[model samples]
Target: MSTMQPILRSLPRLPAPNLWQSKFKGSRARGHLRVSVMTEDAADAAVKDMQISDHPQRSIIEIFPGPGQLTRSMVMAGAKKVITVESGETFQESLKALEQNSEGRIQHFAMNPLSDPFDEILLPEHTAIPGLKPQSWDKVHEDVMIVGSIPNSATGERVLHELLTASIQRMGVFRMGRVEMYMFCYKDAVQRLIAAPGMPPRNRVTLLAEAAAEITPLVRPGAAHFHLPYDYQLLRLVPHEKPKIETSVDVMDFCLRSLFTNKSHALNKVIKYERAHAIGSEFLGHPLLGPGAEILLGRLSFDHNIKVKHMTLDQLNEVALKFEQWPLRPTVLYDDMIMYESRRKR
Candidate 1:
């Protein structure tokens, strides 16, 4: 038998699948979470497909790693260190067992990626661990990577949204550098994430995600894995060495949210309806959108009648940048109440 077989066999079995149902009772009942317990074979296949062995020095942060099945696969596949972040109490014991057997290769932490403060988890003290060191803000941190399965619900979309926002702002784990992410997302959400200009689902999420990273679909959903849902897709997100959108997160977010509110309306009409004119009376005459410009509304001279959803990523980014540079722009684009209490200090 291969050496990997014995290592895999030595890992503890996952708790009964029924236990997952109970643990995620509320989320499952609301159809907001889909629990897929990967068979050992499926777990191995996923790790192989992800090419984990190619970067043996990189630390892997596995989110919601139930019972450490995928965690074990990564360890056996040549991952030198695996930090498992699990929110639910259901699998702590099993994960602890794996940590013991791995001889310090596996570290388990109880934290929710969706709601918890990442600053608390990725503390400066933790950077001493191999592959957890921070890198310059302008460079990609080649040593760090994140892997997780996003729920096939609105909750899942929110997770992606928050992560993308964090990346744009260079906050959270992104503070270390532009870390890479591989996630299993709902197939439909994946489409919306990488959607191009004029696509049916192109909106705020698409614009921000494309601006922040290079997103690609790596694995299509199929029946190969036990309990693997048919509507999931494995996606890779590598943040740009420097994101294209240079404006503050609040400014860009406000512009995108306002513009996409009536995506089908003409750009000028949407701006007017959103009352964005309050920012500046001469908004139309701004250099980015002046009559001499090729794209009158922004630096690129496009027709004023273009539909909001049809604008290219660059065009959307130009609009946000222009808003940020406007002389009469409001001091605060968003209400302080919307920010998390912990983030105010930053």
Candidate 2:
């Protein structure tokens, strides 16, 4: 099968890191905001699964969808049909995406959601997918799902209006009333959606992901601990259903002499027996590994003489972002959060 790398390569990368600044202005400071508030759809989906084991009737639509491997896996694992939308001319991206999906819950739609072209992209047949359509929303669980990467170029005003309008559209289409959309989103857009004056309260979505909240021992190639730089955190809209995901393989066990002791041998074994889905690259939009994130957060830490108390989860999270201001990969924020707590125990 084709891989995640090839697919992601087809999409446009975000502009130079300078533009990514000002991501957390709104939600970062808003403590009253809810974890569920930012991610009601995801939470509702979980609730749906709890209430209805067979989400048999839902259909999904994701816009400007990217390497949809995970959601596809989840849907194929059990979700009904998923309708994915894309604007660029990537051929058969959706069909290829469906192959990797676990339950075949995804389909692709190539249309410009910004224009009238969007209306033409809808399938007459999709109106019937279980929890995905609007007519049957009340009777269904969170049967419909919508997710994708938000174009970084979108303006604050445009994003705010689009988020509200799109949420309504997705809700109108699927049985999963108020379908949720998870995005590799801009922080500014999130703030605008929630804090923009004259915005609706119930419709105010939450900040599901960002560079806050800490966790530790969350690094990869574990020994690179000190080499790691920057503040990072495992910020998310929803707590992971699977709290820990391990991608490690033991070095040597049964029969190791000379040829068998190679690390390459272990990697090969990892590739063989472990889930093939896990073998692909794990993407994290970290500030450290990416541009400007490390320097931004790191400088802020020293500038403030930042200090953590009692290794509280919140404090650990604080430090993780500070690490981002330094020089490290963003995903390492997860590790730093844990390490912050480990030091606190002392």
Candidate 3:
């Protein structure tokens, strides 16, 4: 696949971008929201920034995709298929609209995602993807899966499971441009239900590790999480003994710093993560150095966190071991303006 104009624009923007500027580079930065932050614009920029491999032979595959300004931009850029799953016919339609109005081709299919036979919708050209009996979209650009508090709301479960199934295989193969899995998010319940479908412990660990690999393989959140109003959380497929937040930096910094001495003074890593993400193949030999360090890295590294607190301690240990080289970080920080928003809301 030759570099298309769409591809050019999709590439991640350069370092230290000015948030207020028109070329706002990142998708989810520290801001005033309480959920994941990837405007259609940010998402679009991500796809473009993650240009299809220069190899021209390695294809791209996208999972649990949604429609909006950014997704539309992806289809236009020449991604063969952005296999997204949605249960609601209406949501599917809304997502398809981006493709419909786009200069690109899009295929939207209505799979209950939970049990709906995927075969009904998946076709060579359309975007509805079925179980991984692979032929290839061959041109997959990036893997995009975000598990966060804001959720798809309407049909998240169906969409999440299906996308996860599709994306897990690519966990290492394709670098995650953005994945938002976390503990507090409602998705945690969904994850807990699925972790041991009689699945192997090692397999689960592999998935968790791979998820870490996929999400941050390319993109990294900044020194600060998104602003105050924006919501974000860290998740694990299994549980662990770590600090977490229902809201804000004060409590967050307190807990983590108490656990790790320098955690408080350390500059937010969100910016570094984002910049490193653009560079690709993330390996923090000693990414973190503290009790909270592993937890922080795992949460921020890939932009995805799985909820494991509800799981058994045994399960937690199985997955928690990775905190040593945890992929996430305490990189995200709330913006000053977002602080004002919180006060205003009160």
User: Tens digit of lDDT per residue, candidate 1, span 1-346?
Assistant: 1132223335556655445444433344444464443556667767877788777667778776766777887888877578888776666777888888886778888777677446776675665243365787666576778888777676777788888888887888787788888887777888899887888888788888987888978765363443433356678898988788867777777778767755777787555433323233233312212222223255445675889889987777777787677666556555532342224236
TM-score versus the correct structure, for each prediction: 0.79, 0.35, 0.34
| CA lDDT scores, all candidates in order | 0.69, 0.32, 0.34
Model 3 stretches with alpha carbons more than 4 Å out = 1-40, 48-50, 53-66, 88-93, 116-229, 232-346
Task: Report the number of the highest-TM-score candidate.
Answer: 1
lDDT of 3 at 152: 30
Off-target runs (Cα >4 Å) in candidate 1 are 1-9, 15-26, 124-131, 136-140, 221-230, 275-300, 336-346
Model 3's C-alpha root-mean-square deviation from the true structure amounts to 17.7
RMSD (Cα, Å) for all candidates, in order, is: 6.9, 23.1, 17.7
Among all windows of ten consecutive residues in candidate 3, which has the lowest summed lDDT?
270-279
Please report how far candidate 1 places residue 289 from its true position, in Å.
15
Residue 90, candidate 3: C-alpha displacement in angstroms: 5.5
Cα lDDT tens digits, model 2, 193-213, are 333222322121211111111
